[model samples]
Target chain A: MRMTDRPSNEEGALAPWFAAGREAAPLPSGEFMARMEALALESQPAPRAAPAAPARQSRGPGRLLARLRAMGGWPALAGLTAACAMGLWIGAAAPEAAVDWVATATQEQGLSGLDPASGFDYAMLGL
Target chain B: MPYDAMTDTSDEQLLAAYAAGAPGAARALTARLGPLAFGHAFRMLRDRAEAEDVAQEALLRLWRAAPGWREGEAKVSTWLYKVVSNLCIDRMRRRRGGFAALEDVAEPADPAPSAAARLQERSRAEALEGALAALPDRQKQAVVLRHLEGLTNPEIAAIMDIGVRAVESLTARGRKALEGLLAPRRADLGYEDD
Candidate 1:
């Protein structure tokens, strides 16, 4: 209370008794405190279980294997086999120019066959 | 939390920590709030056993509410006081139409050395308690919360779920009643010298 907000005479008269009441405010018995403590602990919600460690994700070599498995194991292998057979067929029966280009790709890796000067050469021959 | 730090922690934080299973949080909260609930219940009911039961019940509700407690919505102390005030009201209603005898009031929770030394103060406290017991429950509660408990009128209004003016009125009327009740004993209680 501030000096300006002084208590009325009745309030002042009653103040000491209130102070006594405050001083005499009951103390919870040890047994009561223990029971409350037990209740508090018992009622406590378990600390939200730490978010379950993110499910271990398969990585490294297992990643590709997992993807292949996801794509349906034997069907994915069959697709690769079919693609390889197509490449073998191209190798066995393709034109000589295609074979030469393939040779160029594997050997010098040069692409002069794709150069614009070759277009001019074709124009000169009118073919 | 260290023992010292828990004293500084707000009730909501302590409750949140308790809900989250922080060690020592339970005891710390109990230490902070137990006496308050018990004291208010004791003063209102003036029966040690019933007051204890009411205090336990009030704190039990608090424990149950811990998990869902939201800060900034309501104060923990105010909530507990409100619960206690209501619980006391319910208890008093169960025994309505009968007034308590002066001897039925319980003794001081802890008899302080100073209080025991000053017999006059103890008599005055007893006299006031007896006078308070005679007031209507609402008036008694208002007066107790306002004067004995030293709470603000608005806080008492919230606890009692009444308007501030109503609190002021009840307290004023209650004190007047108490003065009337205690007037005869004033000379005997040593007010003449003051």
Candidate 2:
């Protein structure tokens, strides 16, 4: 067959050559396939289960809020709010007292106003 | 599907089954895609050992990508062809001292009944392989995929990441070059007539 001729499935100049090539085409040996299968199995990600039907989540923020309300209601909310308010008030009103308490604690621990270098040295001793 | 049922399933479905961790999908894929990958690599590399490595590595990548594989994006074989092609190219680039001369590459032993005919066949195959090796990388790849692997121009284009026209041109040029290379040995290769 001429070079310009398209290669066809039927017998032609190139057909024998292609046939030989195909016959000579190297197949993976059984050992090679086994190794590849092992590698594939090893590399394969563990299958994720079908997600457990999404756990039947509460539909919306409204529903979630409603559930929370049903569990605790306004009394619980009021108590939590009061406790937060009390904590904030103490923080704002007793800043100096808080600072003094921190200072006292540090002094008792022998770390009062220590410079970073001294702190590092002290930390080096596993304190 | 049952393991027996998977035998007749498409490659895409097999890959999906593999991704889903079906019990038999790994074996199914191995039995299916492993030979294609090996043949392609062996044709490209002309070295059985390296080809085996390339095939295993290609399959390993497939396994790693199975979980994230997007079905219907491309045929599993096409995806594998692309991967094997690129891997072979990478290996060729990293080969020390350049491409091995044809004489240095070993040919597999043939088992034909007649020694003379077997030798001639072996020599013909080796000559073709040598000619193929001498081709520029793209032309060689195009020719191998187009002719030896029996893939369509479009499929080859997809694997080589080129347009169909480009694939056609490359294959044509490759065949012409092969014709020139092998013409002088026509009689020896038992192609005496034309």
Candidate 3:
């Protein structure tokens, strides 16, 4: 932006060489631009859908690896396979599986005991 | 809104709009800039196919960067010049002896008379490319950016990440060397034949 910032060489000297190049040879057509536009259009990422809060899937050994593969293919598959296998093996050796806590807790709490008409604790005996 | 009217819009503006879901903005941006970028690649690399490949890669990068683009810093062309220049330099470095050979100098024969002339023109272009390749890396870039690509000194300095005075010195050195190297074929280049 400052004159001091510019090149010390005079522009008039360059004008002749550039003028000769342009006059003797002007650049060709605009085809290259068209091609670049096509490439840009093709490469643009698609718009993302609104976040619906993805339903949580219970984590499993291969889950992360599979998702990674879906994004990056073979490179990811090679890097993730051993880790995923180890995770799966560890999971298979676990003594107990994770519980359906929501359903189990609801049933165990016996809040289902209040019958509207009878006012009875129907779930008191774990029936 | 019409895209031509969008010409005044900066690349950062268009990229942001494109990321925001305006496909037209992307189209306009590329259409406006493609040739200049491609021409730079072509002249710098001296290979149409390679230039096209570089142009495609650079454009793809533009799209990929659109979403997180921050504006008001670098001009898009300046960024692009840096990207493409680095790519060309990388390619040149990868191929052993790919740079210009000063010893390979040959006089360019007149092209327009016969098959010999055409061959001469091709060889001349190759020789010029080689002489250019022989220059120091910084000089070659300075020459390509300033002369062949028609960028101004300050703009070239920005792209090369150097100061303007450095750009001038580099270009002067580059031109002196090129003229000396090509001095034998000045006639072939339409300069006064030595």
Q: What TM-score would each prediction reach against the true structure?
A: 0.76, 0.68, 0.59
TM-score of A-chain in each prediction?
A: 0.46, 0.33, 0.27
* TM-score-better candidate, 2 vs 3: 2
Q: Is the docking of candidate 2 incorrect, acceptable, medium or high quality?
A: acceptable
Order by DockQ, highest first: 1, 2, 3
- Maximum-lDDT candidate: 2
Candidate 3 structure quality by residue, lDDT tens digits, A1-127: 3554433343333333433332322132468667666767777767666689978777784697677767797776776888898788767875354335445655776545332432254456454
Q: Is the docking of candidate 1 incorrect, acceptable, medium or high quality?
A: acceptable
Q: Which candidate has the highest TM-score of all?
A: 1
lDDT of 2 at A16: 67
Q: In model 1 chain B, where is the ten-residue run with the lowest total lDDT?
A: B102-111
In model 1, state the lDDT of residue A38. 86
Report per-candidate DockQ. 0.39, 0.25, 0.13
Which residue runs does candidate 2 get wrong by more than 4 Å?
A1-12, A50-127, B1-5, B96-110, B113-119
Over 4 Å off in model 3, which ranges?
A: A1-35, A45-127, B96-130
